[model samples]
Target: MSILVYAEHDNKNLKTETNKTVTAALKIGGDVHVLVAGTNCQSVAEQAAKITGVNKVLVADNAAYEHQLAENVSALVLEIAADYDTIMATALTTGKNFMPRVAALLDVAQISDIIDVESADTFVRPIYAGNAIATVKSLDTKKVLTVRATAFDAAGSDNSAEIVTLSNVTDAGISSHVKDELTVSARPDLGAASIVISGGRGMQNGDNFKLLDGIADKLGAAIGASRAAVDAGFVPNDMQVGQTGKIVAPDLYIAVGISGAIQHLAGMKDSKVIVAINKDPEAPIFQVADYGLEADLFDALPELEAKL
Candidate 1:
């Protein structure tokens, strides 16, 4: 039995999450094969081959897969599903979008957002916004899963494997192309950041976000916002840190002006070291924080910046 992993890339550059997915796949007890589907992604395929446990890399270079459209990717992955006992991908936007389609096409349920490998067939995953862990056993002939990269350590490039080009181009001719709306930021992306500094409604206004600049710069942290701040238009939705937005596990998370709602805590409680600075001594964030500072953030920001 072999396991197939889908390698995610932007056609030109490989995403770091692929390594984490490969690492998780290695624990599933099988020979691992990584599939790189794109128009011209040989370099990306070769990069996947460099991951330690991958046995072979399949490069499906096709015009239809140029954009990694869910329909095309699902068709291509489903075409090869019969050859493998398990199919896995990173539980990112790309995988979440396509993996369910593959499962539906195969008439097998997908084990979404797997956090632990119980066996070759069974897995552990989170349900109800990570409040509890569910141990799931897949009964299908082929087990399909999407792994949460943040839950596992990433695979290293300790060895090289064979790179095989897959020339089979199965085209699903369904195109609903639309204009892309892109938001670029100099600050690190929240999902990939090692440290995050988030603010709540206590920051008061959009102008108060500047208070975090010095501290974030010193710590190399991404700026994040609580739901209240986002709802107030103090920051964009992309910066939101809560149960509904991105789940982040960083080395250090500094919460300023945040009272810490249960929804917000659910998203960041897993962070290694939580530090909270709030004016209210009775704020809920203080309950979980490793270090709690009950003071005005306006006064604390400069002091924290000076110390950092």
Candidate 2:
């Protein structure tokens, strides 16, 4: 069986998630090929060709694919869908947006956020806000999968695969490029950080997040927030970590003043080590924390920052 992985890049650099997704594809036992779709993204294609298990790299350099609009990318994937048995992408914003369109167009089941591959057809995915693991067998001849990158090790760069350019392009004029309001931060990307420090409603206000800034800078950690913090306007929605937000598996996760709602646990439960700091000893976060400290954050933050 041949597998096609959708390369995730920013035209210049390949995202680590793509390498992790490739690892998932390799585990499915196939000749792995990566599809790099973007305008002026030849650099990304070249980088993908070096991934350890990739057999070939397909490049579709066109303006329509530059922004990776779901309408256009889905159509492009469908054009070559017959060449591969499985099509996979990282379970990120981009993949979550377009993979369903491809599945719907092909009239097949789209397995979402698969954490494990039991076989070529049977996969293990989280369900019910990650409260359960569901093993599903897809009856469709063609499998379209969105892999959770945090579950797999990234594929190393060890080989030089042949690169093939494609002329087939799709442009759905229904959408157009618009302005992007991005939060520019010097800190590490939240999903890829080795250490993450997060706050919750207990933070009270946005200015108080500075308490984490000193600690984050000391450890070179990324800052995250619970859905409560976001809802309470203590931080932007992008900084939220929960079932409805970003998924992370950092080596060390620190929860500050979080009550440990199940939705919040679903996002960072995979962290190698978890530390919870809350005034209430009975907070559910202590249940999953490797280290639990009962203290007032106002007092603890300064002490921790000084100690670090």
lDDT of each: 0.88, 0.95
TM-score of each: 0.93, 0.98
Estimate the lDDT of model 2.
Answer: 0.95
lDDT of 2 by residue, 46-153 (tens): 899999999999999999999899999999999999999999999988899999999999899999999999999999999998999999999999999999999999
Worst 10 residues of 2 by lDDT: 174-183
Task: State in Å the error of residue 58, model 2.
Answer: 0.9
Ten residues in a row with the worst lDDT in model 1? 174-183
Provide the lDDT at 3 for model 1.
94
Evaluated with TM-score, which candidate comes out highest?
2
Residue 227 in candidate 2, Cα distance off native in Å: 0.4
